[model samples]
Target: MDTTTYPAPQHRTATTTAPPPRGPAATFALHLGAMAVAMLLGMLLLAPVATALADAAGWDQAAAGPEAEALVMAATMTLGMAVWMVHRGHGPRAVGEMTAAMVLPFAMGLAPYWAGLVSAADALVVGHVLMLPAMVGAMLLRRSEYTGGHAHIRARTAWGRAVEAVAHRWPTLLALGLTFDSWLRPGIPPAWTLLLLGAEYLVIGAVRREFHRDRLLAAHIAGFVLYLGLAAVAATTPATVAGPVIAAAWILHIAWDAALHRADRVTWRWYAEACAVIDLVVGVTVLLAL
Candidate 1:
């Protein structure tokens, strides 16, 4: 055997050539069409879904008034745009800018309404109209990225992967939380609402067939008893006591969500994560009575 050690030959590395730019005009038209679809979904499809969910959940979406309704509409539009953009293989930064553009007009309009400077109707109309220009501005900010015809589906870093996961999987849960966060502002939750918690716990556990596990069984029974006790307290006690009790229950449920999440036992991790966030929102809303 030859004793001389030769250095290993370097392998040829392949280089990726980016595709030609789509040009601003093509990019703008594509985004404009996306906006149109988003607008259509917001007004005609998703808004009604939010309203129906609110109705079914005894949330009384109207009681949140016009500003909240406008925000919900904005959120729905953002959701539609986000889903469509991801489906179109757009990059996260570009998608984020588009989402911000969709929501900014609503936020701007809401400010004047909150300050009593503008009527809700005018604010809403202005917000809707302003959204188009805001979107144009966002596209301008990412001119190169948006106008480029190169594949937008670049390899993601760990942070980018995490962001894309949230942007894709968690929007609906966030929207649902927004839709119902106002539920506690009016008064104590309805009797059915409190009872529903118990049912929800049982169903969530049963679906996993995890009730056969001793620890899970004990946990579910404890949760049922706690919910039942809360329902009783809410029914018989004064609002002063009931509100805090209900709020505490909601906050406590976050712990339940955590346990299930860590064990990866009951529901999908996304549901657990989203439920924790929603629970915290409702809990704080009840505590503040806002």
Candidate 2:
């Protein structure tokens, strides 16, 4: 050797680097894809329910007119999108924007259609065309969100979500009950109402052993027995007596439902709320009929 020692070749270790964040275009595409999928899935999940509600309400889309049908369709689509957006860690602002994007287009077009400036077919076509631009606008308003990594968290507690879901349906439930009353003419017999009330208590009492152990159960049982006796009396009595008894029973049950809902006892709060609506509506209907 030349008497000079060369430094040993420096050893180099390669350090891996994370891939860069997706570009804006890529992010936009990804969000669009996810939204498309979510919309599809939401439709799959919610369409049948919407259809059933429409059927229950006797919507008769053809007779109700295209605008009414379009409104329902828009609502269903928006609700689906909103639900998916929430699941994807979107906040309320994003959800609301998306809802507006889906609904506003269709809703706005109705004014022109009603003014006879556009035919029904033209209004529907324009609405459909506008939805994409509206949705894109909503996305652009929150560009950072779509570009950023998703945050997989829910803003609401399970109970809160349950209540929200029920809140949306209470109006529908009331409508359904009223529709049923319309169909049933004079409504179910008073005896049948008492029998149904007892059945409801049975469900409430059977849901948990804690309910059975509660002292309130004793009163509930007594109420159940009293209902049975009253049912028997209603079955045997004249319309004059049966009508008032049934109306009174329905009115009393409305108060009972309110109490149970406030106490958050026995049955689900949603069920109690629904029962109260049904009780009040049916009771009022009975009173009006009388």
Q: How many backbone clashes does candidate 1 have?
A: 0
**Per-model C-alpha lDDT, please?**
0.72, 0.69
Weakest 10 consecutive residues of candidate 2 by summed lDDT: 11-20
How does residue 166 of candidate 2 score in lDDT? 44
Task: Give per-residue CA lDDT, model 1, range 28-73, as digits (tens).
Answer: 6776786667556555546767776788788987777887788788
Q: Candidate 2, residues 142-219: lDDT per residue as tens digits?
A: 887676674433435786466345435643443343345333455545477797886686666677643645677876
Residue 139 miss distance in model 2 (angstroms): 10
Point to the candidate with the largest TM-score: 2
What lDDT does model 1 reach? 0.72
- How high is each candidate's TM-score? 0.50, 0.51
